[model samples]
Target: MLTITNVTWLDLLCLTGVGVYLVKQVLIKKNPAPYPPGPRGWPLIGNVLDMPRIKPWLTFAEWGQKYGDITHIEVLGRHIIVLNSTKTALKMMDSKSTFYSGRPVIPMVGELVGWKDSLPFLPYGDRFRQQRKNLHRVIGSRAAADVYNEIEEVETRRFLKRVLAKPDQLQEHIRHTAGAIILCISHGYEVKENNDPFIDLADRAVFNLSQATVLGAFMVDILPFMVKVPVWFHGAGFKRTARKWRETLEEMVSAPHKLVKDQMVAGTAPVSFTSTLLEGSHVSAEEDHAVKWSAFSLYAGGADATVSATYSFFLAMTLFPDVQKKAQAEIDAVVGPDRLPTFADRDSLPYTEALVKEVLRWNVVVPTGFAHCVTEDDIHDGYYIPKGTLIMPNIWFMLNDSRTYANPEQFNPERFLAKNGKEPETEPRTMCFGFGRRICPGVSNSHQLTNSLHLANAAIWISIAMSLAAFDISKVVENGVEITPEVEPLPGTISHPKPFKCSISPRSATVLELIEQDANHLVHDNTL
Candidate 1:
């Protein structure tokens, strides 16, 4: 039935069909990777619209629930992987640290903060390792512990004074004392009272840093190509703000460095982080100056973290009297009313230790923490994570995960205590600093020593001195309405409560004398 033209058409059709089948098989073999489960979203803007601008931590947690422990999403062509479980975070971010330790290049933090040089935000490479080595040499766990006596002395005295004189501004006092201690150690400066130069500078620096990291700033980071367009033509406010922040931060950080260096040359400098850097620079002056920004990174990082934690401690004490009573009782039973607790007593004070962990869990200061970027391709649970993926270990969710803690909502210290009231069981809370190889290197010694010796006991003493002794830290109610704690914290990578009122008083005559004596002996360091 076929004619000459029909015979040719039949031959062409058979060849075309064979070609199609071969191409399909080749494509399948070339790309046989699987992605983690995630909510389906439009191309080039996956889940961006769904993400909450503020409190993205809560939103991320919800997504983790909808998706599995490891969820993948795309924002403006960039891939992000959120680690919801501790096991996965530790396994990938820790065990395979070389791949997950680098930080994402956020425009606000990187461009504005000179992050090409900032240690915390720097990528995982030789430069980062060098900077981290410097930090370890100067303020590593062991060295941090060594510096605790000064931290304890300064913070403790300030707490005692605040309990005796100004209770309303206790929050500021606590913040100032903790901040000033880090400032002094980092730059050889102490803020004895309000309006100290160092304190003012640090406050402004934090504000600018926070403003640069808020949700608004991320708009530019998410769409960096917009930044390539002329500011006058495209007309976005991101460029202007980014420039201002860079200049402000440089001025704030550079001025202090110059002042400290000058003081050292003029023979008036005390032992400080800057001084240590300078001394070490003599061995490798060129390299050290190149990474001098690392020193400022420590100041900025250590200052705010400690301050945030202490402020939360105050809030916790104000809200939960029973928690305070138990901690104070432990402090009293171990050290008695005559003397203060120290780092040596940490093992003996199990309840106090539990309270510190509970505070960290209750109000997570750095909820999402700083973002970490994947350096290479990796696999977790049969899914492929490509290189350059932004890995966020959902620290807030891990701490509050109901599966781990019995009642995650309430601020209960007893959760960390032993069930039978014996020596206590395994600590329920995980590391608040971070996980794996990148876990906060400062934690083991300097940070821990400072908290254990002065800050922790200082908070307990302040709680006992003010709440138990003078003021009632119970909730305030007015006009037939119970006023919940007003914590309109300045939005940033970190947060603290807004100012509120709480009653203050002295518990007894014996306690009152000890407070007064302690305050008198703690001299204003400026006049020293």
Candidate 2:
């Protein structure tokens, strides 16, 4: 046991460092006010052991019930403030955003993999404001975003044909369609129907991002010093992983941007977010980098969120046939069987809109949300929050809280409608996109304002409407018995509905003809 082989230097280094960290923390002055209530963390390691390895939002929700709305915890000498209620989150992150809009630079995901330039991990500063302003030019308002309706309609129609051909590959079709639309919008690039290089590259990068951001997934995140450790050292495998992931991420960010630039030089670049920003400007190296990264962020953010929501919509349709039937009935009355529903028809279909809202509310995507870093030392609600504290809003609990939503577990679109003289429940879009200055750009908003056009929400609505109009989705039958899919969301930065079985078929021959007609139209139309 005393031999060096039995106990490596890494273990010794970690233990010694923990002891030093604890001693240093103990020598510091006490808090100005007590931290908001939370689980009592152990010495040295703090709450590291108490933190859940999976679905931490569930644990955070339990903490919310036990210790008021705001819960505090410390891990590796870092303070975290978990806001479990919308009211508390709004007051802290919204009303006082000046002190709470910063994002903690994750060692593994950011510094190691060079993802810091992207919005999800970007710090709140002038750069952040600039990127938002850039997005404003493209998707800032509904009218501005409507400029791309043909693109959305074209790609979505292709999605229907893909689904019709390969019903078993529904998720793949959704992923492909999402990438295709975002690629067109971001760089005017067209993705291949199968095994596209750009799609493969971006998918691998995003998966790595989700894995890298998981709490305690890699030791480098906790002991940031580990990043500086030699790759040759034992137990330094994550460095190798970070290297490979960084390459993938670099390609994901640069490849499409390069394509746009090359096309621009050739005098044949289509109008897109990237092209529009670069066309008339003699851009400096620094400005060019900003444009490239901002375009990638727009693509990454809008695409991933749409995939999650659209996939969840299918899961919802399978799980609740009654809801699906009700939605289809409304669609039938409003849209009819002659053609599929389009964005122009969205306002006339209230029940379908409610159904889409319910899908969003019923399934919590981005469950815990990315952490919001505190920029200054401030006391919130009589509790002292240190300058570098990470403020995490448990968005799942807020959406599912029974106090706000009656029968919160039920999949009922009626909850969003005024029925029997009862008012509608609080809108989920207001809370789901997140809070404050760092609220997700281009995400859904309750009131139409001068912000990005809620691309992900818009994509989800169009896909759901068109799919419902074209197909009937239900549980699969095997061995003469219908199989119901189990409801579970896989844990990650972007939560996705677990794999499920469903049967999708054309609602009528007319719908199939409609899909064919759209495809024929796209074949002739080069603008899309």
Candidate 3:
């Protein structure tokens, strides 16, 4: 009887183990929803080899055409969802923003290079909200137009002078102008020259950060366990690079902020974004920290983006002289040649306004809208999207959709104009800025002021109008040969036209005189 009981007990234990295995299998098969269709990739690597190192957006756009608006792929176990259509992006990133606002953890850029504090890469959480709130408080659409208009105007006038002095270095002048504007507004520290230390450090930091963020650039980003390896270990060059980058990033964030605080203490700080935040009523330590990083974030990307758009404008002007002529005509009729274009003149130049929209759409600054992360498992259009998926909105694909804009590839501003020859009822702000809660906080300020018709648009608009009003951009003539400018843009997250030669000359001696007059007499109230 004892032997029989022992055998029975052993059998029962074996049966129990089998029962658990069967139950697990059932659970796994219960919710087997199909993943969104994508190009067939290798087993293990799973599209890792298929990813493009440069201009990945172009490939993603092509895939969107083949696989549909919502395409999914995997790279070494990580899920990536590309939203190709504006309608789908709005539905997911806009309508269900809460679930899609989370940012993916970029080990190389965010963790190694120490950019986690930057608002752009911050994950969806209380800290992100705090940083964003502080950013909006200082530079929000309403506050920017009211507070930073003078600085923008003064810097832009300086820009005109720089371009007038050296027409060949138009790109350099635009970059310097962008840097100067952000520096003045953010730190109350004027950029004395094009090679200001602050600007140099910031530029270096941005360049390194951009390179690091490129997918597949660093092996550790794909296999995060490699982060545990020592810097002295073999094949660990990225670790040393990250260390140097971190130091530069820290100085970029802290140095200017410290200067503003020191100036405030000396009672000589200029009225600026940092000054306002630091001197605000009843500020706590946490809030002050938030403000410092938020201000740094603004200075970091603001100039780069503005520079790219302006460069595109120059490219557009060179390629399409007709657009330039019409725009100049409009600017002359509204502001005239005596004075440069101003924010108040924005409304009067409808064609100029349409040109701004066209520039944004023609070659978007960020073709792939910054990636967002999924916080929880979700399903859309009968496709399964697991939690922690990386979401990339293909802004290039959506902007170039032929259905939405007729002849999308053509650089025509009339697409944004109505039948009545006025601004269209619906503009493509979403394509330019992004979607949902993670949308660019600076979009409002970048485009225009709130509820102000005088300045239908913001700094870029004023700069473009004034540029057209003042200068005639045409093809460069070398040895009696008209060098046709190529409109091909460099490949990166923030793209600009490849270096092209163009002849930029004042429309008239009167325009040059006006630029000089404004440059000399523009009063900058640096006093707080």
On TM-score, the leading prediction is: 2
TM accuracy, model 1:
0.83
TM-score of every model? 0.83, 0.95, 0.90
Candidate 2, residues 472-523, lDDT tens digits: the string is 9999999999999999888787788998989999998898898776464653
Question: How would you order the candidates by TM-score, starting with the best?
Answer: 2, 3, 1
Give the per-residue lDDT of model 3 (tens digit) for 387-470. Answer: 899999888878888867788889888887787755453366656667777766555422242343111136677678778888
TM-score-superior candidate, 1 or 3: 3
RMSD score of candidate 1 (Å): 9.8
* All candidates in order of lDDT, best leading: 2, 3, 1
Please, what is the whole-model Cα lDDT of each candidate in the order they appear?
0.63, 0.84, 0.78
Worst 10 residues of 2 by lDDT: 519-528
Please give the RMSD to the true structure for each candidate, in Å: 9.8, 2.3, 8.5
The candidate that achieves the highest lDDT relative to the unseen native structure: 2
Error of 2 at 173 (Å): 0.2
